[model samples]
Target: LSLTLYALPYTLAERIAGPWSGALAGALGSGGAFFLFFANTTDYIPVLLFSFVGILLGFTLAWWRPVIFYPFIIIWNFLLFRLDERRAPAQTPHLLHRHSAFWDEFQRLPLVGLDTHLLLVMERNRQEAEAAMAYLNTTRQRWAARAAQIEQDARQLMACHSIAAIGEAYHRLSTSEATDSASALLRSFSRISQDVDAAMRQESAYNRRLALSAVEDRLDGLLRELTRSNDRYAARFRPIAAHWREVVADVVQQLAEEAEMRQEIDNPYIIGVPLTEKQEIFVGRSDISSHIEQLLLDRRRPPLLLYGQRRVGKTSLLNNLGRLLPSTIVPLFVDLQGPVSQARDHAGFWYNMARSMIRSAQRQRDLILPPLARDALAADPFTGFDEWLDQVETVLGEHLALLMLDEFEVLDMAFARGRLDADGVLGMLRHVIQHRPRWKVLLAGSHTLDEFQRWASYLINVQVVHISYLREEEARQLIECPVEGFALRYEPEATARVLALTRGHPFLVQLLCAEVVALKNEQPAEERRLARLVDVETAVPRALDHGSFFFADIAQNQVDLTEAEVLRLLARQGEETAVPRQVLVDYFPSLMALENALIRLQKRELIERIGDGYRFQVELIRRWFARQPA
Candidate 1:
């Protein structure tokens, strides 16, 4: 029972042990060694007749006081050692064992590595010497042989004079103390040598140009021969190049097919097809909806501004809000895309509103809107605007119409270009909101609020809400939702890569996912499974290369691969404090377009302005960019 209890504690201890468990085991062994040396020695031992008790004493006292048990082993060891020394030396002879110095050295071996410093120094020196020698050989070969021969002859003639002077000077020095005239002879030899050197240098220069011309003539002949040979060879292999071209063309077509498969939404505003299963509803401006909802719930209206960059989804949000309004309230969805003439014709807007009301009211004809909308539509298109609006108020109560005007800022742009009567249009809209307190007006557009602030009287009546991109967490979940499978979730690394690359841009995210799914056959096994996968790597960057396919349509006609290369460079510039601008220009001269593209990207919310530059909104997009092979 006691053993069982002690065993239980040890088992429990083992189950809960952490990093300290190994140290604990080592400590127990060391304590036991000391206990064995001290225990059952000296005072506890009885006098043996012939042989002492052979039985081990630890079995019955295994659970006894540890402190007393430890001291007994210590005394026992001391007495045994004392007894052994006093005994015959034959019983305790030293044993022989082989020592292995090689084994010891092997066990103490250093980690493996080549001598990097020596290798680098040798490589650099070899490269420098090779380059210098190649340059010297090229220069020597380019010189005229005839001129060089003349220079060599001149040097030989000069060398004989130098030798004769040295011999004379040696004889003069040995014979007697050098005379003052000896210096004069030496000076004359130096002048003669200088004259010879200058003549040789001139000859050498002339020979170089002649030799270069001759080399060029030989090179030109060789080039012509090589070109003829290549042309013949190419003619022989014409069918093979054609076959390779066909294969490449098939691969490109497959990529396009893959893109079409991945694109989810087939809409004009969305730049690309959706590749993932995530739903992308462009809610451009929620402030208008929230304010409208507030008015319907609390019976109050506040002016609103729906401002964003072009194609930023502002118009879509208002359409959604109009759909959400109750049937009792007439929802008029208006498009201001037409010319100012259409806008100024109040009767056309009223006619369109009547048509929308008729369509909705057809569901409940007995609700009184049917007859009223019918009567409005039956009226002439050129009917007085004031009379039509008054008739509309009489038909549907003053508080019934939810007038949603999309692209209101188009008028501002039109007026700036002198395409519209701005005062008349403003006066008309201002009159509708001010006179009809019951009517709720929602104005939306893809312009900044500052651009349309001039319409204060009309805007002051509604609330403005800025609808932005999905939060990082939301975007990540949305991106991975399509690929999440029973076998594995998206690996953090793979998901991070996707997010990092797309930067949470809705269209881009979907487009990228579509491409990825096309590659993976839409199979989701493990998150980071794509870490080993290859990406779609083909893109024509004509803008980066001057006169490329893309730049021909642009303003300066300077197309390039700069945008593509910049993306790659930026991804590799991870954690860098700053990257020099010249690095970009040196590699791809179209870097100036990057700033313009970045601004456009921001407007579309592909990237966010942080400080000096931008970061991907979706980290996975950045990670995906990082995973792309250079």
Candidate 2:
């Protein structure tokens, strides 16, 4: 009973530790029971004391592992006289050694390495952990540039006001998306790509306008599908397309209905937007037109250089040249800003010029040539442009052609970039003038005459007409004359305030007038005018939406940070005379630092030189710049 008590405690303690520990406990408990069976009945208390002490000793040795549980068990039986070994001097065999044979049974049991098994399991789990980490690291994000492009495409869709422009825009977007894997929406969008492409591919159709009309229904469905798609890109940009879809559809429908009767109509109060031949609302610039006509009538018909500040009606002047010039002069206007920008070489420049010249002629006058003549002109028209012009001259015998190349500054930059051949293009212009006497060229830019020194030799004989801001009378006509057709009127003081703000600049006058008119329109029809000077004054500050202006062309594209600071300071001055150049230099560390920036701003027409001072050339620009956050 005493040995049983001793073995019970040790067995419970060792079993709680480990499998190996539990085996040692069992050995101890069994050894104690054997000792109890053989122990003397007369000295039970002494025998129980020895059993407890001996079982504890065996358990301590067995726990160390170096003694090993099996070895401890064998030693235990010997010490207790339980084993019948050949060397044992005991008279009878031990009960455990002979009858129990527990050690023999334990040896027959299979061996296992629990520590090694645990390491293998841990290694497998590590592989699963690494895979989970890799899955978490993977991303389905589209790049920022791709999102920007989609936004750009959406804006283009909104701006495409023409029938052909809409079809062309859709086709271009689809073609771009085929190469673009920006998002899953774009990838899935290719399903109807063939339909969009074939519909927009107007060249393949027999009747161009009719083919476009047929595709309108299909295009509407496609746009709806685009709006319904569930994608991050769609979520970002689909709303922009959807918002404008109705407006765009209305415009397309109108253009389609009046395709035959449509004529270019000029809005008298057009601001930032250039006027076109379709518009007849020319408010001023009679003086500039007279000067250009006189220049064209000169013996040589020398190139006329028209230079002005940004948004000062340079494009409007070019657009109205056909109507302004004598019918005999046959004024031809070509906006080479886009083509010249994309021009790669002299050939490309000539090709762009020839194509524009041909297109303008077709649009203005239904000038037609024989198919053979057209074919000859089409083949290498860049080099054979003079020949084509000679052919055109023959077709319209004695017809004087005044080719007006608007936005010539872009062409100038093209030459500087080495994308256009300096000698070849300039020489071509000089040669065309020398050879083709009837073809009169008008070169207009926002830059000063000195900026044109790069092509000085070609323009040596050209007449430079410096465009000035409108006179007060002309500015008044723009503000008050538009009211005649629409039954609107302006207060005398309102006109005076407009003259004060705009400084008779054409674009600013248009913008200020448009703002006042928009506010007046919101009121009752009778109240829709600048009759209330108070109302006009109040709306001036709120009417200027920064998004409506093309400040990006100035802020990001043209000026550097230093030049922008010069503008900001000038803006703060608010209609005051320009700050002195020396004072501006003081703001900078040195004169040399601001010299390039000043020149750049001067070239872009953002700021102008006035005596020893410099100021923003445009009045509204000053107002806009002042509003920008520091």
Best by lDDT: 2
Report the C-alpha lDDT of model 1 over 1-630, residue by residue, as the tens digit. 323323443345546783234223333433344445446666433323101211122222222323344455334434443454455544422110011111111112211111121122223353432333333234322122222222332233233433223223222221211233323223333433342333223222222222223323433443344345544333332332233223323433553455356532211122222111111333223344555666554444555555554333454454455444555666555566643225444444445544444433332222334222324434553344545567667777644676666777665766676645566566666677667666666667655555466786445655565555545665575456532231123456666655655455454444454444334434443332342223423111111232122112321221235444555566565632233555645666455677765555456443455555555444433444455677
| TM-score of model 2 (CA atoms) | 0.55
lDDT by residue (tens digit), candidate 2, 95-116: 3222112223323211222122
User: Which has the greatest TM-score?
Assistant: 2
lDDT of each: 0.41, 0.60
- The regions of model 2 sitting more than 4 angstroms off are 1-268, 340-349, 369-383, 416-419, 546-548, 577-585, 592-618
Q: What's the CA RMSD of model 1 in angstroms? A: 40.6
* Minimal lDDT window, size 10, model 2: 109-118
